[model samples]
Target: MTKEMDVTEKIIELLHELEHCTDSEQKQKIEEMNEIVDGMDEEEFESFFTLKLFNKTDKMIEEEKISMESVFLLLKSVGQHKVLMHSQSYAFHSSSLNKRFEQMIIEEEKKKEERNEKLLIDLCECTVLLSNEISSELLSIIVTCLLKVALKKDENEETQKEVEIALLALSYIEICKSVKQEWYLNEIKEIIKYHQEHHNLTHLAYQSAWQFLMNRFHFNKSLDEVIENELHFSRDATKELEALIKCVDWKRGKGEEKRKKKNKEELFLFRWLQTLGIFFFHWRLRNEECVGLISSVVQVFRASKDDNREISDKCIFCMGCAAENRVVENEDLLKIGAVDLILEEMQGPTLDNYFLERHMKCLFEDFRRLKNAEDYKNEEVKRKATKRKVFDKMEEEGFEDCIIGLCHYICLGEFRYFSLFENYPEYFVYL
Candidate 1:
């Protein structure tokens, strides 16, 4: 341990002396320091990793010898130093990595907007690569830093574009650690203050900002305030909010193309919608008018069924609740085809239809709540166009009897509602 301590002191001395040392001395000392840092001295683990010397920081900005362009190589070589980076004594300045980044960006802010895009791309890649190892406190340090740069209040067109990309990329951090609390409304509210000064970021900032608010706020704010702000939002913000509201309102199995594309994105976005949905349903949007949002969720669950089983099942179960909501509110999601899509996905073998066989009672039982048969007997509801629409689109592709059975179902009344008796006798078809 003494030997390691002596060796580290020597390295620090060599680093400081590099300014005055001759070429030979500098080269030899640098190599010697590298060897010691990388050496297998057991007690040197914290020393080697921390690299904090004479109250200096490990963040490259503090090291005058290293330039911004070389930060990547330095971080890659020196790596993270928990003791040095997080130690209160040798901490990064309030600006930290972000300050240095903005300094570099300021030189190019007016010249080109996309210039800093590569840095954002790199930050996202590194975040994904290191999410597991780095402390959240340290990660939040990075996040706060990036937010400052990408969200610069006086940003011009070029900077706004770069910040937008940065917003999209930074969202990859999936875990919140014990050491760090999630940055919520305050972070967003701070960004909103920037909008009046530089409106170009209104659209891009709003995408992530509204998403953040949706995840964080939901019904916590007054419903009238939420809706009024939504209705009068900076046009771009309104679009994003509507998209979010649509998602929160998802029922069970609504959209086709979207549900089918449920990739890694579906895993998180649907979860966001689910959590936010619960918040609103339980808090602000209690009236029946708000029951319409389930259509979006149903579509997501139906589409993303292949990505996650547990989440999909939960979504299907949610559909039962939404159905109940519709009944209680005298809102007919089925009339708008929310129920019909669920029924179609339910009858099929998609993984998202977990509640299909299980929750039939809950779904159909909503019917008992209707005051009169006419509530469920609208011409379009009785017509049931989804089945016919599918058959017609597939007709040219050649499913003669399938089309016939569909047509028969369309024309037949309560006496012969299904096809088993008529179409299957000539030829049996198994689902």
Candidate 2:
């Protein structure tokens, strides 16, 4: 017999022995199989996975000759082998085998059978490792099955692991093809809603799923084409942005609460806002949609100040980016209460030079744009009235003095406003 044939037979034999092997022996047998697969040349690796392994596993599963544990171990061992994964045959083998594996998952889901978590994870890992090489059709099937597992709502350790792997897989999927379909876009929307609404999804799973959708729409090339085609994602993005803004309870407490560190949920909310901030910075939405997004970001900036400096810093940064991006409308500035928030932040007791300067620059830019946008001939009266209101508010809030004090530091070429404020008793707030 040929050497390749000999290796294939030995692999199949080990898989059979793995079925009934003791837990103690299973690891040894799996290692032995890994050693063989790891040693195969490109052609042998391709032939073994494409021609030998799938047929053996299919028959073994059909005859109940393999335990789920054994099947998963075998599949994981073979699928993760360096030689096989790097082989030219990877695309064909991954697509065909993933399709077959997806069918079994579908059947199990239909029967409501409790699946092995390792099996699902291994299945997902092997497929995702295919990267952009795997067929979009096969990816859709796998993603559909995994989402079904996640939405099953079993609410246990098993469900958490399932959802975690599912989200991890989603994060790795290349957006080249699947995102073009309407149904796939709807699925993305549904998953976003589910993450925001459901408390059962653990932080890891929640973050994974959010990071996936965030990256897909925020950074992927597919999103460029989607936007170029005028596909509607702004509404969904805006809704989620609104939910993120409203979810934080910044008024929950003060003095004593200030001593306590942020809880996991609070931390996740603030961090995800940072992620969304990056998304909004790059995403181009219509003027009306930009209106809602900027409004929400300003709300977070206003309320994130109670006790959490980190949250406050993040929200402040987001607001600055929103303003810098010109998403903040001059007419809507006062209506959205951003101007008031800025003045409040400038006058507030706690002062970080960087954040204070950011708020100042945003307000300055807004005022600058407001002045430039007024039509000198026709809107002269309206411009004077609006300018009077803004200047009057600035004077009432001592914002002019704040600006003068800030300018003093600027003129001195000093970047450390806190130290400058320390010597000026009027500007200093001693903790």
Clashes of each: 17, 0
Per-residue lDDT over 1-431 for candidate 1, one digit per residue giving the tens place of the 0 to 100 score: 35656756766665566545555565555556556554423354345434254123224246455333334433322322221121122222232453443344444343465556556444433332222233343454455545665556555776775565445434333323321224433455556555634565744344444444443333344433443243222233223434543443243445453342233233335444444344333342344344444554455565555545555665555555554544233344544445455445534544222244333433343333342345446654543443344334334334444335434433453233233234322211211
Model 2 misplacement above 4 A: 1-161, 168-210, 216-253, 257-260, 374-385, 416-431
**Whole-model lDDT for model 1 versus the true structure?**
0.43
lDDT of 2 by residue, 241-327 (tens): 566556666656664623443344465566456555656566543356556656766666666676566666766666666666665
Please give the CA lDDT of all the candidate structures: 0.43, 0.59
For model 2, name the residue pairs that clash.
none
lDDT of 2: 0.59
Worst window of 10 by summed lDDT in candidate 1: 82-91
Query: What value does the lDDT take at residue 281 in candidate 1?
Result: 37
TM-score of 2: 0.52
How many steric clashes does model 1 contain?
17
Per-model root-mean-square deviation over C-alphas? 16.2, 14.1
